[model samples]
Target chain A: TQLLEQSPQFLSIQEGENLTVYCNSSSVFSSLQWYRQEPGEGPVLLVTVVTGGEVKKLKRLTFQFGDARKDSSLHITAAQPGDTGLYLCAGTQTGANNLFFGTGTRLTVIP
Target chain B: DAGITQSPRHKVTETGTPVTLRCHQTENHRYMYWYRQDPGHGLRLIHYSYGVKDTDKGEVSDGYSVSRSKTEDFLLTLESATSSQTSVYFCAISELDNTEAFFGQGTRLTVV
Candidate 1:
């Protein structure tokens, strides 16, 4: 079973549209991260959220960690074509040696 | 860009052959990981190393083995290549546990 699940599995929207992607799990994580992967390349870290109920903003992108630390969300406002890519959420559990990644959400922003 | 390099960016091998992918990093990170990406499965860890000469298996470690004899290099080996093992493999490194990880470009392996 996937330790983390993300939805929607695939998304398509026009330029200037707004969308939200979610990552949910039954297990609580000590830290959570979001990554973006372009074609033919590996994933790159976008942001890291460690505290529960913490919200961070990166320009047009907003990330929030759930109050219980079991979920998180990524929201993009006025999305552009540059936002098209596979978005992945990863989490690290307390005392765990490895990080777990979620089933990715592939987003396509059309111009 | 994170001082990580993966060799043999693309390879095609026959079934039953052995294949090894290499990950080298200059960051001197304490943690190194190997993961495979497939359709519907996202990225699943195969193995990881915490320190030189110390390694551990991840959830999908059945057909793969890893070694970390040196702090800067991690290797993933396939005992016997199978069509099912064809996928893009990635290498990641982090300075510490539960921290931000930087990933290598990837190695695309195809078993025919």
Candidate 2:
């Protein structure tokens, strides 16, 4: 099993604060994806990083894949109250489409 | 918003009873997956179907079974429900195995 571990299981920050969430794994993956889920809703895809050491930005969110494809990080600049939700990192193995999801990071941005 | 829907949005059943959840898709995607979400665990894949009548087990498939008879429908069954099986279930679809998946709203199951 490819285990993905996420640090800072929970984060509470003020609006406009900057924060980063990390996902680490010992097994390498071909691609990694970030998803955001709110209460009573399914997870929504944020970004997918395929190449190693790649970075993608979506508005205030910046996602980066590790050089070895075994880790990833998501950084939010000037977080807003609407950013309060659960962030999950999922990795797809080199030859598989089944995604392994990390434990998750619950972020609460107080306005 | 990929036109995915799950039936019985909320269900409550006694342990040992059989329960089935249905997923319907309008996009005619070839891949369909069943997942269960708990508090600490993000989401566990129960089963997945590559095509009609072609299914495979996932990481967490022991207690669950799935069947897809038509192109647009996938059903997940819990042969004998248990309290531990109480969780929110989500169904997702994708055109390709490695593509972005579209998820249904989800079904909340409660096994007493």
- Candidates' chain A TM-scores: 0.99, 0.96
lDDT minimum window of 10 residues, candidate 1 chain B: B94-103
**How many backbone clashes does every candidate have?**
0, 0
Q: What is the interface RMSD of each candidate, in Å?
A: 0.8, 1.5
Candidate 2 global TM-score: 0.98
Considering the true interface contacts (CA pairs under 8 Å between chains A and B), give the fraction that model 2 also has: 0.55
Please give, for residues A1-111, the per-residue lDDT of candidate 2 as tens digits. 439999899999999999999999999999999999988888889999999999999999999999999999999999999999999999898677598899899999999
Which lDDT tens digits does candidate 2 get at residues B38-107? 8888888999999999999998898899999999999999999999999999999989895787889899
DockQ agreement of candidate 2 with the native complex: 0.66
Give each model's whole-structure lDDT: 0.95, 0.93
* Cα error, candidate 1, residue B55 (Å): 0.6
lDDT of 2: 0.93
Error of 1 at B108 (Å): 0.8
Best by DockQ: 1
Model 1, range A46-78, lDDT digits (tens) per residue? 999999999999999999999999999999999
